[model samples]
Target chain A: MRDIHTSAITDAVKKLCMEANWNLEPDMLRAFDRALGRERSAAGKQVLQTLKDNAELARTKRIPYCQDTGMVVCFVELGQDVHVTGGGLYDAINAGVSEGYKEGYLRASIVRSPFDRVNTGDNTPAVIHVDVGPGAEMKIMVMAKGGGCENRSKYKMHTPADAAGAKDFIVECVKTAGPDACPPLVLGVGIGGTFEKSAILSKKALFREIGSPNPDPALDAMEKELLEQANRLGIGPQGYGGDTTAFAIHILTYPCHITSLPVAVTIECHAHRHKEATL
Target chain B: MSVTTANDGIKDLSTPLSDQDVASLKAGDRVRITGVIYTARDAAHGRLAPLIEKGEKLPIDVRGQIIYYTGPSPARPGDVIGAVGPTTASRMDRFTPALLRLGLKGTIGKGYRGDAVKAALREHQAIYFGAIGGAGAVLSRFVKKAEVVAYEDLGTEAIRRLEVENFPAIVLYDCHGGDLYQEGQKVYAREGA
Candidate 1:
């Protein structure tokens, strides 16, 4: 069995949080370059430039990219052969999140209780999802989600006949959201996964690179069709008029109960900051 | 590298901004802004209405000022604030009435406001400028100077006065209640719809 130190996990978590905030990952930058060229509107082009400028400023100044900093979400994959050396593995992960948010100068957006609505001061008790895999290696994925896009998320169960109804609902949601989530945006549509799973899949879909087609032929076609409908809503970049409201629409689907059709749309603004590492 | 100039007062924002000036401004517009603006969002607007009810001393004067609705993150070391970006504007719909009455000239943030806000904008001759929602990096470049003028205890959510030069933004919903999002969509849509 491979011996694992809890402190290692903690330190990695902390450092990862800080690093993610301070720097924009290379892949994200490449995607931005592609977006700059695809955008047709002057305002859309300008927003892309500022986003690039922001990335540069964050790197040179060693500051967090946005003031929201975002709530921490960590996805972990562990090797089944590994055994913990000291302390609880879960606590170690939380510790990493705490230190990273604290030292990194990121915002403390977590709350103690949803009902009370009190800020937890530390962006702690992160949402951690762990999976046990076959090897001796551990992989971690981190994403900082902000309110602008989070607040606009929508999910619904539909009957087969309701498929057409969904187009209008999704379009309306985009229009209502306007430029708030920062356009040109990327839309994540999760189909077939259960209520929460659909939402999770929708978010995970955002990690996919822009312009990458879905592996499933049918799902890819649906994604293209959705993109056509969404941009037609006229919610251009930052809600200012002109084309290029969203950069892409990525969809993930699973088999659902025959009677039900589940769909979840997670809107991601242009900033879309995320990072991952394998240990 | 951008030249720094902060806090020149009302003169800083007097760029003679018009609907046309901002109409074509897509998501990011970086212009050195000089002039006066107001600040009011959800909580402040809520308190202001009650004060207008009781006629007490309001914390801020909204006349001829721009109100930004964001509650930002803490300031990082050697920097002013962390990841500062625009917050949603619909939350303040209830208290917007008092703001128009107080002579507020403009509101800046992401997203559209309710019709009542549009009516208020029309009645008060005000404008709504749309800043990039998550482009805090781009937005912060224009804010050459920032200081917390009120509500220091609120942490990132506290009220502050900022002095900006050539701060970029787009005219989304203007004084005439024109929305750019609608216009842009029409251009990109193909013949089928």
Candidate 2:
């Protein structure tokens, strides 16, 4: 077994947190710039330009790209062939999130109780979804979701009587959402899972990069169709009206109960601030 | 007290902004507004609407002032405010007309307002500027000073008087019923144009 110290893991998590908060991934930059080129609306182009300028100012001044740095979500792939030499691995990851948010000046957006909210101050207790796999190394992906679009995500059970209905429902949600999700959104569609599983899957769908397709042939085309339909809404960037409201639509699907086809849609705004690292 | 950007015909809020000043602005231009701007979101607007319904004196006099729709994060050490960016503007749909009659001059936020607000802006000679949806940190550079002036119980949701400089925003709706968002969308909307 490859023995990893608890402190080493914790240190890695903390550094990853700081880096994710302070830096906008180059891939994200490329996506925005690329989208700008494909964008047809003058208004949409201007919105993208402001985003580009914000990126320049954020990088030069060491400021956060967006104010809502978002709640910390970590997708951890742990290796069964590895052993921890120090404290437990989960503890290390949590500690690192706390330390990173503090040191990086990221806002403490989480609260223990959702109804009667109180600031956690350190942005602690990261929501970690861990999957154990066959390897000697661990991998972590970090995501910070802004609240503007976060409020607009939706999940519903559609009857399997009509196969196309599922896709239709997803398109309506995007149209109603309009420019509210900050436009040029990343659409994560989780299909066929049970209710909560579909929700989680939809969020995980955001982990997919811009313009990537699902592995399934039929579903991949479905993703492409939905992306085109959504852009047609003319809710342009930031809802100002333009040729692009969505840059990509990613679908993640699994088998569900025979009677139900549940679909969840998660919207990621243009400021898609997420990063991945290995331990 | 006059911290400005663009160095143009920027004027104070307490005094009237001329019709010429409002007409000169194009959608994408940037301006740093010095002086007092009030803060309110859905919840705060709810409270203000009822007070206005009774024809009661508002907790704060809002005549000829700019209203920002934001719920900022709590500030940290040596900082005047946190990432205080614009919230979605459509939610204020029902209440803006009454406030417009009460002497409001401008509104700031992300997303577009509906017909009611657009009519109110035209009838009242007011303007609506759309701030960048996600650029809070860069936008924070303009808000040099802030203080809670009302609804202190709302915490970060409280109403504030933010003194800003050269705050950059696109004029989405103007006094003449011109909407940049609508015009821009028509040009870029994905029809077979």
Candidate 3:
């Protein structure tokens, strides 16, 4: 059994929060380059170039890439054999979030309650998901999910016979979101799970490298088709209109009850910031 | 600040835009704004309307000025302000008409305005411009100066007065009811798909 200290977890989360905010991952940079090559609209190309430049500037200046540093979403794969010491897992993660947002000069965008709408000041109490697996290592992945794109995410329950409608539903969601959700989006599609599980799966799918193909051949083909259809909508970069509305579409699936065909689409903006570390 | 003229096809605009100035802009016109604009997002807008309804003085004179829907990150020492990008504008649709009625010349944000906002722009001779939504770090370079003008307790949501130079934007909605989002989509949307 590998004993991991909570302090180490806290330190990793803190560094990941700041690093993810300030720097664009290589996959994201490559995706930007790909979009720049194919974008037909002058305005669209200009927006793409500016985004690339912005990424570089943020890295060099240690500035948060976007003003909305986003609410941190974390996924942890904890091994049964690994024992956590010093504190509760959640306490450590939240401590890291609070410190990272404050120390990194990132925005504290969380509100204490939806109704009262008071600022949380420290951007804490992250949305954390944990799965226990057989191994001696603990893996932590983090995503700074922005509220604007999160607001546009949607889920649908289809009768098993109507599962084919998933593609159309995703396209419709993008159409409805239009320019609001920040086009040049990366769509994470989750298929065939319980309602809530599908939503979580969709978000988790976004942590995959931007241009990488899904491991499953069937899901990989579906992603390609959905991506093509979404881009054809001409939402473009920032929805000013162009050929590159979405850079990629990633799909994940789980076997569901015979009656259920649940699908969820989680829209991610171009500043798709995520990072992971293993302990 | 010296203004860049329209010779290269980009219009140079300044704050406190006059009626004629607003009328001259059209949907899809690229522009670079120079001079001062104010920042306000959800929380700040919530406060402004109550003050207007109460017939109380606002913390800043908003007449003929532009409001950017933004909540910037905290600035590091030696920086004027941190990554200050426009937020989703539709969230402010509820309070927009009121400000437009009070001589608000334009608003800078990302995304579409509602039908009522379009009507208000037409009635008031104002405009709506969109900056690249996620390009906050690049946009911050344009903001040469920034100061919290009101509601400091709201933190980043506080109203800030910013002096910008050559801040790029595209006119999304003009006073004449031209809508860039609609027109651009029509032009670029693949036929028969």
Candidate order by lDDT, decreasing, is 3, 2, 1
* Candidate 3 structure quality by residue, lDDT tens digits, B70-120: 999999999999998889999999999999998899999999889999999
Displacement of residue A184 (Cα, Å) in model 3 is: 0.5
Chain B, TM-score, each prediction? 0.77, 0.86, 0.96
- Model 1 misses residue A74 by how many Å? 1.7
How high is the TM-score of chain A in each model?
0.91, 0.94, 0.99
Poorest 10 consecutive residues by lDDT, candidate 1 chain B: B2-11
The digit string of per-residue lDDT tens for model 1 on A1-279 reads 898899888888888888878787776677678767776767667777778888888888767777677778787889998887789888988888888888777788777887755667778888887879899878877778776787888888888678877656666667666666777777888877578888788887877777788899987887788777776655566766545667788888778887878888888776676777777
Candidate 1 regions exceeding 4 Å error are A161-172, B1-12, B15-32, B35-49
The global C-alpha lDDT for each of the candidates, from Candidate 1 onward, is 0.70, 0.77, 0.90
User: What level of docking quality does candidate 2 show?
Assistant: acceptable
Give, for candidate 3 chain A, the lowest lDDT window spanning 10 residues: A159-168
lDDT agreement of model 1 with the native: 0.70
**TM-score, prediction 3:** 0.98
- lDDT per residue (tens digit) for residues B59-111 in model 2: 77877778888876555578777666788888887999999888887788887
Per-model TM-score, in order, reads: 0.87, 0.84, 0.98
